[model samples]
Target: MTSSPAAPGSRLASRLGFSDRVFIGRAARRVADQIEAGLDLVENGLAEDLRVADSVADAASRYLYEAGGKRIRPVLALLTAQLGEGNIPAVIDIAKALEMTHLGSLYHDDVMDGADRRRGVPAAHAVWGNSVAILTGDILFSRASQLMSRYGDRAIRLQADTFERLVMGQLHETVGAQPGDDPIEFYINVLADKTGSLIAAATQGGAIFSNAPAEYVEPLRLYGEKVGVAFQLLDDVIDLSAKPEETGKVPGTDLRAGVPTMPYLLLKTETDAASAALAVQIDEGVARIADGEDPAILDQPLAELRDHVVTQKTLELARTWTRDAIDALAPLPKGTVREALTRFAESLADRSS
Candidate 1:
């Protein structure tokens, strides 16, 4: 399983960087170079995009950006943009918009989850309270829209669709499993909407804005969504496996929050009385922690759940999704971009094992 936490983007970045013994072709290196150069522009533009005339809005908008991130979505956009003119002005703008949207969501997530930290710093909500944190998210969404406005109707529509899916995912997650609903399937769908949709949009926007062939558009979108699923599934494994220092968050934060992970959900599928008892213990512990009791009470349950067979099942599912993501690339033409994409998908699976 995931024995240690890695830097946010380092797994895929290493693949793109050609860290393996197999020599990356010249074209692959060129695509990698283009992405590297584009990242600088994205970083600089992100700062400017988050700036505002109002001092509080400016600080709040820039808070997470300053804390730093893997910038995986934006970099994926830049990489796919190589299918056409690399780093076109429109591509840069789209990358910035997608990143802004992600940052905006994180602000809202911290508030909803009552998270204490993000990116190794205190969460915006923890520092500024819920109202300010929510407003900060709104400000970033507004800025993202402003950036998208530069691209006209099609871009605006795409942004709206992605935003809709993002909100709907959070809503479903908050409302939770309905009567007779398959919790496993329900959770997977939530992940697709929450994490996958925007990532798909990011890569699709890159291809569209860069004027890449129409055929590549759908394939990239599919690839992106699957990759996003794989990424989050690995995160489920990492949340239990990694130390706080490694992941930049406390182990079992989701458990303490009473949020059901894939592993927990899978365990719920078990019919054995022993499994049932463990699940009950975990549910009780999570409920206590959520009700403001000492989180230390969860230590035993969390440890037991982490080492369970269900956790291994979750890791295997993550690998299956990663394989499916690579399969989505079958339609793309043989080139460095396609190769890099395949490697990126594989790298995600490698994280879980």
Candidate 2:
């Protein structure tokens, strides 16, 4: 029932359209490859640090080194750098710092979410226990700060602000999950920190690395924020629509966790009766699941919710955000890089998982 990863090359061709695709086919890969190489440097940098630590560091290294994700932050950074005659090494350092912070957050997030798996493997907290996992996350965060500081005052300030935004975003989500939280407002606020901050940091950091003007930085920041929102919307959609094999995590996990995502928000707006019924089902299911009761009883209802309502609405919202993201890029000079970025935004809207 799970879907396969769309071929990267074919996906680029399809999304970029014929004329743009030809150019992006060459340029995007170059940028993406550079980003991957930069990420390798980051991994090596971390490994070097770990080598000097005690036995506890080995456990932390093992947890942090697991493979997952597309390194999109670093890719964005590299592409932004390529937009100008930027310092590539400095940009890579910043990108690596951002990724380390992100990965650290994920370690803590798994602990908070009580998630058993990440990318189809046991989560750090699940395998290493809460104490080691928490310490591991802290270590990564500390190292990220140390790394960013090496770039001097400006980079330190930028990274500090980014981390602040990240924390605020997570805090908003935690508070927004209470019984009476407005779903629409909740999702917007949550994503601004949880997803938007890092993306904004990625693009803005890129702009900084290039020493671009304020006008350029603002647009890139807006573009990144919009894209981040779109990406998270698609993620919410996938949680409902994708199978375990495709997503590498259980489907309906959001509902299972009582997380009110955009799809649930759209469902709330569609019909009062349906929303009320769905709410009851969710509440009951969450309680039962928490109590070690049968979750199978809720499966049919959740399926109906996904098929009959959430998917279409979520996709539409994602498309809207993607359009906004593209529009934010309007002021930037037209080039293969810009074109490829636009195409990438579109693909984010359409991706299956």
Candidate 3:
């Protein structure tokens, strides 16, 4: 199930023609391969230390490790590290740590978001229940931190800071859900803390691994931040636009949860007074769905509102962030890694999930 990295020239060419299915198919396979390498590092590295623990813990760890993810953050770290001469082992260890942290967050996030499925299967919480899921996430987080501590690399501080940002981002989203906050600002801040922080970690961790200059670190950080925002925006857009079969989740889950996302905020901004009133009604209807009311009741209004506003605006915002992300990488050296990352940024806008 492990993915392999594509050849450099092929990867670069794929980026140049990202919209082409043939090119994208190859590029995705390459990304998947690189991600699998990092996941293997995380799995084997942790197994060596934790295999003697209780069978439940061991099983939970194995289940999570096998359930595969995009491994975007680790790939970012690995590719960025390749920009400078460095010990590959150390770079990979850092990449593994980042993936561990990310998967840990996803575990907790599924619990918090009440998600039923992930990677097209039952979520950790669904398989093991909340308490075990929570504990599993804690174990992963601790293990990731422990790896950094044992490695005693200077990048440990950066990893620690990224963890703090992740927590802060979760808190920001929770608070933003309270009455009276501007939805747009809430989403922006949430994205900054939740998505941007890890991306920043990936870039900074890469720079630290390679002992890259501070000037180089700063642009990479910016690139990660912008790309992270673009990534999240696309995620929200796909949630609304993609089929549930493709995304492996119910569409409009955010709207149903009464969570204010970029699309919802844009809908609010674009609607006139009458439509705004109708929008509120739709919001209330969606909120009722969140409260366990059957979603079938909101179908008509939701469809009308979506057609009137949300979808188009979300796409437009995604494109804007993609451009911003590309610009952020302009200061970096022109190479295959940079080209691949830039192509990945553009792909965000068109992602199905």
Candidate 4:
């Protein structure tokens, strides 16, 4: 509890490896240390879990898992477990499984997104092609399920339900919103399915596996889902970052690729002359980029869009989600878990990357 991330063999010997957008103060620091220790075990376990006998499948399956991610999902899992028995073997095991599932999902996401890179390296789909990449995802899912099976039917059901939501999210996104569907609402729901549901599973599963009060489970679930939404919404804003150095991707990349961001989606909902005018400009910018004009040609429009009121609207909406997420912790009672989670929600409200 007295050690920092740099200290050897005390607590938090390694870094948290994500944005410092969680926990606060000395009490929070103690909680963070405990979570960090659990994460160490999860990291080591994932290596063993991800190992495969097939030479080629080995490389493909380990691709993104080794590439390095924020591991926020597992972090959440371990953190909520603090509310009960702390990082028991079951909690660490489930966190590792959740992370493997998350890592696997990224392989599928890269293939589906046609992404060139992931975690600063060439995407598996780019390296080995789509079929191999998708297969890699399946391999990781199998590994995760094997890990979960040791925990009994509850864990199995959790993995199955989360995986189902992951599929439904992709299906809905691929088909596009139905006629008469509120596009904004549909998009948020899709985000929930794809992002929030898994995160919810992580948070709730933490409490459950740790033997925390049953009443705490749903609140943590709600908190996690909303926090997940807020996290992705912030990513939408980050996607528009003019500084490629920060986001490691092009500005307005989503719009150019015909993928809609909430800011751009909000453009349709706004009837104001400014929003209307900006939307028209963005439309033209997207067109030019699609027509083989330099991606840089869209930079100014993106910068303007980045500063537009709709951008503020996007940010405020993110705040609203976080506010609701924190409120979901009301049933958690006053304690380190509740306070740490509240800080976590607050931190996401301001994350730039």
Best by lDDT: 1
Candidate 4 lDDT, 137-236, residue by residue in tens: 9998998999899999999999999999999998898888999999999989988999999889999999999999999999999998998898888888
Taken over the whole model, the C-alpha lDDT of each candidate is 0.84, 0.72, 0.70, 0.83
Question: Model 3 residue 125 lDDT?
Answer: 94
Compute each candidate's TM-score over C-alphas.
0.93, 0.86, 0.84, 0.91
Task: Report the C-alpha lDDT of model 1 over 22-57, residue by residue, as the tens digit.
Answer: 227686666776776787788778877788999888
Kindly indicate the candidate among 1 and 2 with the higher lDDT. 1
Best by TM-score: 1
Which pairs of residues collide in candidate 2?
A: 169-193
- Candidate with the larger lDDT of 3 and 4: 4
* Consecutive 10-residue window with the lowest summed lDDT within model 3: 1-10
Misplaced by over 4 Å in model 4 are: 1-21, 284-293
Question: lDDT tens digits, residues 155-181, model 3?
Answer: 678778889999999988876655887
Off by over 4 Å in 1: 1-23
| Cα lDDT for residue 175, candidate 4 | 86
By summed lDDT, the worst window of 10 consecutive residues in model 4 runs over: 1-10
- Candidate 4 at residue 321, lDDT? 93
The model with the greater lDDT, 2 or 4, is: 4
Better of 1 and 2 by TM-score: 1
What is candidate 4's CA lDDT for residue 192?
92
